[model samples]
Target chain A: MITKHLSEVTTKFNPFSKQAKTCRIFLATLPANARQTMKINSKVLPRDTDAKSELKIKFKDGREMQFDPDKHSIKDVAEEVDRHSRVLNRQAELAGS
Target chain B: MSPRLGICRDCLRKIRSPSSSTKRYLAAAAAATATTPAAPPSFEAQPPPIARFPRTQPPSHKPPEFRKSQLHRQYTSLLRSTPLLLLFQHSNLKSQEWVSIRRELSIALSKVDETYPQTPPLADSTKLQIIQAGIFESALRIAEYYKPPPPPSPGDSLATPSSSPESTNATPDPSNPIFTHALSRHAHDAVYKFKNAHPLTPLLSGPLAVLTFPTVSPPHLKAALSILAPDKQAGFPAPTRRASPGYYDGAVQAGVAKMMLLGARVEGRVLDQGGVQWVGGLEGMEGLRAQLVALLGAAGANLVGILEGAGRSVWLTMEGRRGLLEEEEKKE
Candidate 1:
């Protein structure tokens, strides 16, 4: 097999630029809504190369959620976040009362 | 009648008949002139009797009430959406925050209708905007409540910082730079969330006028439409160019809701009562400036021209203050 040329490899991946693929990725994985609200430790692909594509979300609360952004609607991620937040807000409200 | 009483018909004739009355007055004047050396009074030159409260109203010195024009009132006052959002924000309960905005708007709209005495039926566009705003606000409720506190950074160990907004977890320390940064960051992030979730119905001039949201950008506005009614979003032509007021209608009102949201967000400042008021650095205001500039250009042509004109103060401030990125150029 012929080795790839430098220019071809360079074109495929611009190290400096995060790709539009990311727009579709972060667009859902950690939504604009949740990103600001949650303490997101990291959003990275799994270390296991053989694993099917998935985004791992590490929250400051020590909880984690995994999903494929391309396959799932952004609402799914946002909904999960909503559930967690609603509970906490409820707790705080109750405590205050 | 007796002459001493000054009521006799002969005396009355002297005053009543013009030629006779003139001669009598001249005789009186001549008699007075001889005694006091004053000139005869001309009948025409005599001043008319002063106005009375009975027949004619007295000249009022009361100044006119300085009432503002409808446009000025519209501009100076917060949009109808503002209180709805503020109420939702201040509401202690989380579940209520999610669904309350729509209920509030509908109730308010109905109240406005009842008060107007000509209860105009709700515009379908206004209905649509209310739904969109409510949906996004639910998402906003999620973001607002679910956020976990960030872990302490290396710099934070030197002193306790009020980095976390959740008072339950934080014991506030004033001097920490890290705390200041975190506080500013949280405030800024909340502003963005508010901007995205904010509904435009409050700023609507109704579908009867040319409708638009000067505060909302074209692309995100399109997104809100797609979210609210995907079929309509697909069927309608993309909202790119500025549509003339009163000409077109759609999710443009919803976009306006978001624009208004941004305006509300930028106006908020963090204050500490004990000592200094604002402690956060305006490090990322360039982004705010760009967003506000886009908003300003978008607003000048919206339905509520006065309301959008209010955004100019925000834009002017952004434009007036040199951004840190540009200042770097000047420094070197």
Candidate 2:
């Protein structure tokens, strides 16, 4: 996952629900020092709730992306994040001396 | 008696002589010339049944020498022993971070112990351990699904002649129905069918660490939560810099930020983070018991009041009627 380009990451999921595995894995995929680099917020809902798992990411360029883990796998989520992160990387390269 | 190499002639002759038993047998055979030699002992006699394996060490389906097997055994015992366990997803915490976190947790728990001096101190018994997810899942299945038969009493023997034919078998076989140890083939076969049906299965994936409490002690739990996932709104605020400067250390703070409490298992029931916080918020067993006692006492008092009210109402009605009748008699 292109965590370097992300400014903040937020997730909410029920641990007992099957669909929530993607969100859990996504959180795990973040770099060990990702907390130092980005603002990470996660909330684990109660078991009785059937709420859909949600993942929201804010990129360095102020572009916000939202994903429902119920509809998307962790792979798709990562691919979407990387898609924007590549553009940001190119911009940084052009701006650098 | 002439001396020979290291011995006299008489000593050499004595050493060379056959025993008196051989001479007596020879004489007896000569005296009873027609006696037939006793029949040689029968080769068909069965030896007493003996167990091929030691009583304590049963053959396991997996190689017992391997680390996996030992871990499986350890996990199974851990699952059985701990009634209250918190599951955490730890992402790449440094060793020093773990050390500082542990030190702060002990300090907090010991403080709880001092506050609740009536109960036995459990600070030392609680531990945080990283686990192999797959092995731990397998052990959880075995612990949840497999119910081994109780061991035979000491007076009873597996090899007893009069026992069932299966028990009397002499070989130490893994497939034997009697071997029900956690690592035994029977346990594996019995627990294999469960698969991912367990409620805790989803949480078992990824790098997992468990904080196990020997008992469902709210004070200890509260202290742990205050350190691990401190939330001021949840009433588990993190220690301030003045109170616990070590908790404010860079390593400990970084580790705590990275770790998230996923769920909990309390008395064999799975609970999510919200439920875990609820448990941590509890006052204690004594407080719960006091609440229960107070409720029951209130109910009892209400029952007495209701019964007395009914009796008093009936007595008042009868007395009013009797007074009216007496007044009527006096008017007559």
Highest lDDT scorer: 2
Q: Best-fitting candidate, measured by TM-score?
A: 2
DockQ of each: 0.01, 0.48
**In candidate 1, what are the lDDT values of residues B156-210, reduced to their tens digit?**
7435423333222133333333222212233234344454333322222111121
lDDT of each: 0.33, 0.86
lDDT string, candidate 2, B64-162, tens digits:
999999999999999999999999988878898889888898899999899888888888999998999999999999999998866665556546434
* Residue pairs with clashing backbones, model 2: none
Report the Cα lDDT for residue B80, model 2: 96
Best-fitting candidate, measured by DockQ?
A: 2
